[model samples]
Target: MRVAMIGQKGLPAAYGGVERHVEELSTRLAKRGIEVTVYNRRWFSDYQKKTFQGIRVVTTPTLHTKHFDTITHTLTSTIHALITHHDIIHFHGVGPSLLSWIPRIFSPHTVVITTFHCIDRKHKKWGGFARIMLRLGEWSTCRFAHKIIAVSKTIAAYALAVYDCTAIYIPNGINPVKPITNSEQIIQNQFGLTHNNYVAVVTRLIPHKGIHHLITAFTGLNTKKKLVIVGGGHFTDLYVKRLHELTHGDKRIIFTGFQSGAALHALYEHAALVVQPSELEGLSISLLEAMNYGRPLLASDIDENREALSDYGWYFKSGNSADLARQLKKLLATPRITLERRAKIGQVYVNNLFNWDTITSDTLHLYEKLVAVKPGKKRRAVAAAFRLAK
Candidate 1:
């Protein structure tokens, strides 16, 4: 069956959770002999290649602004997707799913699927109007999709509570990691990092990610170990600058600006501990990656992270820099043997619980159900109709 995957920044997946999610899922779907065409925003995708890893890449034009980028791309991509009359059109991110109704009405026979990746409205990064639109996007996703996939149980429960829609609980997953050994030393030579001598967080440098809190906590910590922030901002320049200002010239704090591939693996492997300071998340890919690499963690005690890691590692009160400092100091004081043992358990847990292969199979099963529907018959979207008449 043919599918059009929309609403992510183009694939080769340099960064961003949504981009990575689409990249991993689409490649696996393609390998299974399914025809998948991924919509790419020309500006976000670095390369001009029309295909990657057997999946068709169709780049569409967008406004490329802070607000309009996602919506504009989703609008044009949805319109463009109609021409192909795909068997299924899968939309990622609620913001892009704002326009999902276009396909629902335009191509009545094509099943529309939306994944509730996160509650985008809760993030402080969005402006007032953007937040309101995101709220409606949430409703659009719940109402327009023939099926909805929630990346974490926390999100699934939230959707059920707020919208009274039971979204499928399909968490973000991790591939089996290849632990970096032999001291490649990219981080070491450039940043002077060594085995078990640094704390790392791989995320987008946006306000909601809570990097400022991490910097505040790390600056006051007594440990000699370094703090490595491995990500770049997404239209949050003021917050990124504020992060640097908060560091106050602490040489121990290093901003490595979005490392991936072997450099990413090196940092993950040698890190003393990986910390996720986000105030909100939809089962963080970085969190899963850290666990898959067998690294112990200290994460914000939000329900989502708790659901993701269970009792795997330490937790700090969300948004509390002082509490985070206290926790950081305490975790650092623990013996290396104890930390390594915890890391080993986390590694095994993530590999078994969040395996990408199983996630792929589960997603394909969902696709099969919709694809098997009798021709000329349209499965009604399960949620209540939107209150608005368009």
Candidate 2:
């Protein structure tokens, strides 16, 4: 089957959960003998590359502004997919799903599948107008797509409650990494980090991620352990600047802007503790990666984090730097053996629950089922169902 993937930043997946999801899913689909074409924004991907990991890469231009980047690029991608003769045009995230109706209306022969990555409007990055549009995008996703996938149970329940629609619940998957032998060397060379002497956070610098809260909490505490942040800003330059400003005089805090490959694996593998203080998430890939590395975790007490971690790690009151500091101090004081044991158990639990092979097979089965349906009949059935839903 020929498929076109839209809405992710691009593949070699430097950052972002959606990018990682698309990269892994598309590569697996390609291995299964399905032809996959990923639509990438020119800014995020190398325009010269024709393919990534055997999947076709189609780079298109976007407006590059924070508001226009995703929507404009998705618009162009949708139009490109319409003329590309793809059997399935899959859109990721609510923002890109807003344009799902375009394929539904203009190219009825193509099946439209949308995955709700998160309730993006909740993120502080969006303005009032963008938030309204994202809300409408959620509406359009429910009404226009042939199938919807939710990355978390929380997201699935939200879709059902708000839209009266049942979406397929498919959580994100994680691949196990080989143990980095030179972890200490890698950390020392990159960020002057000593093995088991740092708390690591791997996420894009954004308001919703709550890195500011973490910075505040970490700096308040008098500890020798370094707080190493392992990501860069997307379009939030001001926010990133503020984060740096927060740690201006603190030598213990390190901002290693976007590490991947061995360096990233080393950071996770050798960390004393991994922290995720995000206020909102749709199944964090970073959290899962941390678990895979068998690192003890500390996260904000948000429903999404609780859903993923589920008593496997320590938690603190959301957005409360004092509570975070308290939790951090307590966890830091705990014996290393206890933390490693907890991390090992959590790793085994997550490995069994979230396997990429199973997720890829399930997704492929869904695609095959959708492809087998007669186009005209499928359209009528969807239209009728949508009307009844209204």
Regions of model 1 farther than 4 Å from truth = 180-182, 374-390
Residue range 163-214, candidate 1, lDDT tens digits: 8888998878898976565554777786688888899999999998999999
CA lDDT scores, all candidates in order? 0.88, 0.90
TM-score of structure candidate 1: 0.96
CA displacement after TM-score superposition, residue 253 of candidate 1 (Å): 0.6
Please, what are the lDDT tens digits per residue for candidate 2 over residues 111-207?
9999999999999998999999999999988988889999999999999999997899898989977765777898888788888989999999999
Off by over 4 Å in 2: 377-390
Record all residue pairs in model 1 with backbone atoms less than 3 Å apart, i.e. clashing.
none
Candidate 2, poorest ten consecutive residues by summed lDDT: 380-389
| C-alpha RMSD of each candidate structure in angstroms | 2.1, 1.8
